[model samples]
Target chain A: MTDLPIVLRFDDVSVRHSGSHVDAIHGCSLEMKEGEHVALLGLNGSGKTSLLMAAAGLLPHEGTIDVDGIRLENSSLAEVRRRIGFLFSTPEDQLLFPRVLDDVAFSLTTQGRKEGEAREESERMLEAMGVGALANAAPYELSFGQKMRVALSGALVHKPRLLLLDEPSGALDPPGKRALAALFAAHPSAMLIATHDLVFAERCCDRFILLEAGKVVRDTVQIGEITL
Target chain B: MTVPHAHPAHPLARLCGGAILLCGCLVADHTTVAGLIVLPAVALSALLLQRTRLTSMARLMLAGTLFYLPVVVLASPGVALKGLSAAIVGVATVSSLGPQALHDAIIRMPLPALVRLLVLQMVHQAEVLRRESVRIHQALVVRGGVDGIRGIWEFAKAIPVVWLPRVLFRADRVGMAMDMRGYGAIVPAARSVRWRGIDFGVVFGSLGVAVAAVWFSALVLI
Candidate 1:
């Protein structure tokens, strides 16, 4: 475990939105090793989302960030994205396609997979997520929990090495959260989950990192040791 | 929930029917009674078959009428009537076809990948905007932002200021999600839908209606 290679690295990364006087996340540095599950806990507006966005290269950042040894630069952005799966806080924002199956298969289709193959793989992923019956349904037709499951299927279907999930269990019931925790437990990828659900985070993550006022306040293996 | 297609026709067939109806509306001289009657008759028939929601249809009609109000004010009544008729036909055709059907048809069309992608994105973003607008409207109503007609007017006035920034932010988030998912690296493969007897019926039926309407308008003119 000690010899595991780093999956994600952030070196003094700072994110500042345009026209803003202050940084969203300032001097944020962290490392995630292969197959590690890390919980990113913070109060609202504490830059948890901003840090995840910066890692995904979705925001302009001051310092360097690396995914699977590849720097998050313009030239390598596409390649880096290939190795990462990002789940937006709002599932509706990411489920762009009309049909559930199509939305799940979109990642694979855009990666040049054949339609039949992509659909088949998407179906399998949906089944695993317990939303197989929803393949033909429209995204707008789904319940919040179902939508979250479908969105998670879409994120996981491509088998990305690093999973960046923002509030994955935000709208779930207790059973849904447990199901999601189980799914995360089974996944082989490294995950950086931004969440306020301490129980959920504790279930799925081995390490906890707390952010306060755009900076990492605590990093520890014990969840009970971190203060929100 | 599975959206039941109002008719069993394939999406492409429905699209073709819509195209014919639109063309007929554009070409037909709506000043004539026969020309004006043809489109509404065809559109109404289609809408009936599709079983579109009455409220949705009414909303679309109202929007269309409002859009041509300037024509009614500045131009001749006949010109405004023509514009309104065309608008009605356009709305009816789209409503009858449904958004999912339209999406399916466009993705399978022999168009440039970028054009298809742009159209798809526009359709998706429109839905997003509508949802966001509804949410904001509900929030305002619950927060006592709407007390009476005056409050309603104020809310309407604040739309551009309150809504635009949120829309822009959501757009950015959506764009980031797309980029992260590698949306443009390759053209997505559209699943092929087989044509049924109803599809043929729709296409031929629309063609016949369009041709007959044009011929009838010509005869009336003569």
Candidate 2:
């Protein structure tokens, strides 16, 4: 355990929708080491989101899930959340603040930093994301690509240990998708990205974990070997 | 992106001023004075905020006045003045404060984090819906097959069918996003309000106006 420095561990974990008969994910087990970037590939409703949600502690599971050796449970939810950054498939979902800057600064403020300091850091993050010009604009006013970049900035501003990205390439233009992949390449945190964009996943991820009907049908370290 | 600073007045001051204007409109015997005072105030605020392009405001007021024009022609002078003043004041207040100011003020309110977050999102959702509606209309226009009244009918029919599904899907995604970000676990963070002397003065001044309006109306009634 010490040699590999596992950042995430899922052991026999399963999740079902509240009123549904089928489990979204069933008996899935996976391990991610520090600096690992894994692509979660699946069709719609195949539990890619559910798996990411479970890792982020957003959904309850039957089996144990741990992040950086910390168990995800009611008592540890806040700590778990603080250590992970989750980006939604739609930028609209995550860019909730009135101003783009405020949205980017949200995590820092929630972590008890002063507003000024948070804003300063948020500005730096937006600038780094190449969206500094959109700081004061409402999220609704931004283009889809701009909003995505801003959402990415918000997720990464606090520098969490792990990132859970849901379809980061979904709405982006080709150039935008390429830039996002490059940005992910530079990020230091471990990441598990759920996406159907195979080309995009190949660009940024070193491993592919494929799901089918809520079960892990394929998990391969060799990206070239996998096809969905 | 740079965050826009709060209004010149503190959030509390703006709230109190809004309340005062609302009360004055409610009690004043004649709409003319209230309209005269409030209209200029709104215009001044708009000018300060640099939102001076008044096309929408003008269009709305024109439509409202046209709707009430029959009343103006047939009713007594007092009745006409009342209708026009009410419309003017209402539009002026809404346009001046707008959603952004109210949003800023709402964030400063000592409400629960979840409530504030919901309110903010609701405001944004309204904008999103409006934008989506416009996009749908634009798409209809680009199709170039539908035209005139037929185009209007088709556009109207298509909006709900096309927009609703997308909105619903987006809503689910948003809810999941909020959950992953730990939205309800703790109160959401808001910009801290710093009330300066001017903020206090503005609040008090609004109170004074409210009191004076009450007195003037009372004496006139007597």
**Predicted model with the maximum lDDT:** 1
Best model per DockQ: 1
Model 2 per-residue lDDT tens digits across residues B1-222: 112333566654565555555465456455344443443343233233323246655775677667777876797544554455445544444345555665787666667777876877776666667777777777887796777788778877886788788788778777777766656554545556778887777666655655665455444321
Per-candidate iRMS values, in order, are 1.4, 2.3
Q: Scored by CA lDDT, what does every candidate get?
A: 0.82, 0.74
lDDT (tens digit, per residue) of candidate 1 on B1-222: 113445677777776776776676667666676765665665565555345578766776687778778988898655765666566665665656555776788788777998888887787677667767777777777787575676666668768899888888788888888888877666666666788888888778877877877776555543
Per-residue alpha-carbon lDDT of model 1 for A42-81, expressed as tens digits? Answer: 9999999999999999999999999999999999999999
lDDT of 2 by residue, A109-219 (tens): 777777789899999999989999888987877888898889889899889889999998997889888988988977889999999888999999888999999899888
Q: Judged by TM-score, which candidate is best?
A: 1
Per-residue error (Å), model 1, residue B193: 3.6
Error of 1 at B35 (Å): 6.8
Candidate 2 structure lDDT: 0.74
